[model samples]
Target: MMQENMAGAHLIWMLILALVVVIPFWRICQKAGYPGILGLLSIVPIANIALIYFLAFARWPAHKSVQQDPSS
Candidate 1:
């Protein structure tokens, strides 16, 4: 029983560790123009696993059209 509890605790810690590394990096990706929820897709199987890799290393969209200032 004690060993099982320890194993559960270790699993939780590993998940927390992954989230700690992913969340802020995800936010940065969002600010750089990717959708923020793209991080959540990282949890999906197969295709999403690839998506995560792509998002992690992919170039964020930096040149999308933006509204111009009327004062310009």
Candidate 2:
């Protein structure tokens, strides 16, 4: 049925959209020394906003390591 095909197409489109949004955030989390799994939160409505604040205010492990280095 056309409706069945549309549903499948919708699911695929949403998955692609999620990946487009998540992959960059996932990479950012990794680079910031946070768990990349945190990027999965991007798909959640309220949690996504909270995640942004969490990322912005949270102390990054990468920065801590750099600050602790004697060469710096």
Candidate 3:
């Protein structure tokens, strides 16, 4: 029926939207030096939700530069 088709279409669209939103955040988490596995954490219960919020806002530590200061 037309209603069934429309529901299927809506489901697909929602899935696409979810991927669009999650992929970039995954990339961002990696860019911020978090483990790639963190992306999979998204499937977990409440923890996953919390992790995403943490990743989106937390300022992770930067990679330390190796060059030594001559003055020290």
Candidate 4:
């Protein structure tokens, strides 16, 4: 009984942690002009590393548009 409770708590903690990571990523992806769904990658083990690298180095569509503006 105690083990089951502990396992359930662990699962809830994991879910909470995933949400903590995902929500900010979702907002960031939207602000970057990328699909918000890309934030789901944050919950994946290997993909999270790839996501960070991509976000760090890849050109953001929003930035591109802003840079292309003649008014800027």
Candidate 5:
């Protein structure tokens, strides 16, 4: 019984930690003009590294559409 309770507590703590890490990563992806769903890739070991490299080098969609008028 005690072992089961300890395992349950460990699982809960792990879930909380995952959420703490994933939520901000999701927001960061959104702010960078990527889909928030992409943040879930961070949960994967190798894919998370790829995602970081892609984010760093890729052009942001939000910034790609800005127009400057010379007449203004």
Candidate 6:
């Protein structure tokens, strides 16, 4: 049926959109020294917001220029 074909097309477009959005986030997480899989957390409502806060506050391992004092 034409409706079924349209539904399939819509689903495919949505999946493509999700991939387009998620891939960059995944790469950003990886660059930030967090697991790329964490980007998938964006699919969750509350957790995604939490993830943003976590990434904002957490120390990134990739940024080696900022050395920490061990004596503290």
Stretch of 10 with least lDDT, candidate 2: 23-32
Pick the TM-score winner.
Answer: 2
Model 3, 8: alpha-carbon shift in Å? 0.7
Candidate 6 residues lying further than 4 Å off, grouped into runs, are: 64-72
Encode model 6's per-residue lDDT on 24-44: one tens digit a residue.
879889998879999887767
Cα lDDT tens digits, model 3, 1-72, are: 999999999999978876776677677677777876676556557877898788768766433222333554
Ranking by lDDT: 4, 2, 5, 6, 3, 1
For each candidate, give its TM-score against the true structure.
Answer: 0.54, 0.95, 0.58, 0.90, 0.82, 0.76
Kindly list the per-residue Cα lDDT of model 1 for residues 1-72, writing each as its tens digit: 999999999999989977875687578658768777776665556756776678667765743423343453
| Candidate 6 global Cα RMSD | 4.0
Clashing pairs in model 4, backbone N/Cα/C closer than 3 A? none
What range of 10 consecutive residues in model 4 has the weakest lDDT sum?
48-57
- CA lDDT of each prediction against the hidden true structure: 0.70, 0.95, 0.71, 0.96, 0.85, 0.83
Model 6: residue 35 alpha-carbon error in angstroms: 0.9
> Which candidate would rank higher by lDDT, 1 or 6?
6
Error of 6 at 28 (Å): 0.7
For candidate 5, what is the TM-score?
0.82
Runs of candidate 1 with Cα error greater than 4 angstroms are 40-59, 62-72
Q: What ordering of candidates by TM-score runs from best to worst?
A: 2, 4, 5, 6, 3, 1
In the range 17-60, model 4's lDDT, one tens digit per residue, is: 99999999999999999999999999999999999999999999
Give the higher-TM-score candidate: 1 or 6: 6
Clash statistics: count for each candidate: 0, 0, 0, 0, 0, 0
Taking every candidate in turn, the Cα RMSD to the unseen true structure, in Å, is 4.2, 0.7, 4.5, 1.0, 2.4, 4.0
As a whole number from 0 to 100, the lDDT of residue 52 in candidate 5 is 88
User: Whose lDDT is greatest here?
Assistant: 4
